[model samples]
Target: MPRGNPSPKLAITIDPDVHENILAAAAREGMSVSAWMTAAAREALQRRAGLAAVAQWEKQHGRFTTEEMNEARRSVQAQLRTSRTVRRPA
Candidate 1:
C-alpha cells in the first residue's frame, strides 16, 4: 500500500502455519500483507495502552472487585450479542 509519506519497514520470522493464516486473512480483507500486519500491530499497541491506563487507575483507586469485573464482563457480552444481531450491508 502507498501512503503520502514513507514508513519504516520491518522483517520478522513466524511459523509456517501462522504465515499462511496471515496471508489468508489479508486476502480476505483485500489488504496487502504488510498493511494487515501494520494494522494488527497498531491494534496490539492500542490494547497495551488501554491496559496500562487501567492498571494505573487501579493502582491509585485500588483494584476492581470480583463483582465489578463480573458485571463488566456481562455488559460486554450483552453488547456483543446485540451487535451480532444487527445486520450490515455485505
Candidate 2:
C-alpha cells in the first residue's frame, strides 16, 4: 500500500454495539465520532509501525543479554554523571 494521504472517503463496518460504545466514548471526550475514530486509527497504525521497526532492528543487531544490557546501562549512567553539571550563576 502506498504511504501518503488517506482516501477522502472510506467505509468501515462495525458491530452496532461496538459503534455505540465508540460514539459514547467520543462524546465523553468532547470529540466528534469522526475525529475520535481518526485519532484512534492513527495511533494504532503508528504503534504497529514502531513495533515492526523494533523487530527489524533486533533481527539485524541480535538481542542483548541481561549482562550486556546492564553494562550498557552503567556506561550510560557514568557518561551522564560526567557530562551533567549544576548551573552556575549566569
Whole-model lDDT per candidate: 0.90, 0.83
For all candidates, the clash counts are 0, 0
Q: What is the per-residue lDDT of model 2 for residues 1-90, given as tens digits with 9 covering 90 to 100?
A: 868987575689999999999999888778878888888899899989977986898899998689987997899899878756643221
> Could you say which candidate leads in TM-score?
1
Off by over 4 Å in 1: 1-4, 79-90
User: Which candidate has the top score in lDDT?
Assistant: 1
The 10 consecutive residues of candidate 2 with the worst lDDT sum are 81-90
Cα TM-score of candidate 1: 0.75
lDDT of 1 at 61: 100
Q: Give lDDT: candidate 2, residue 5.
A: 84
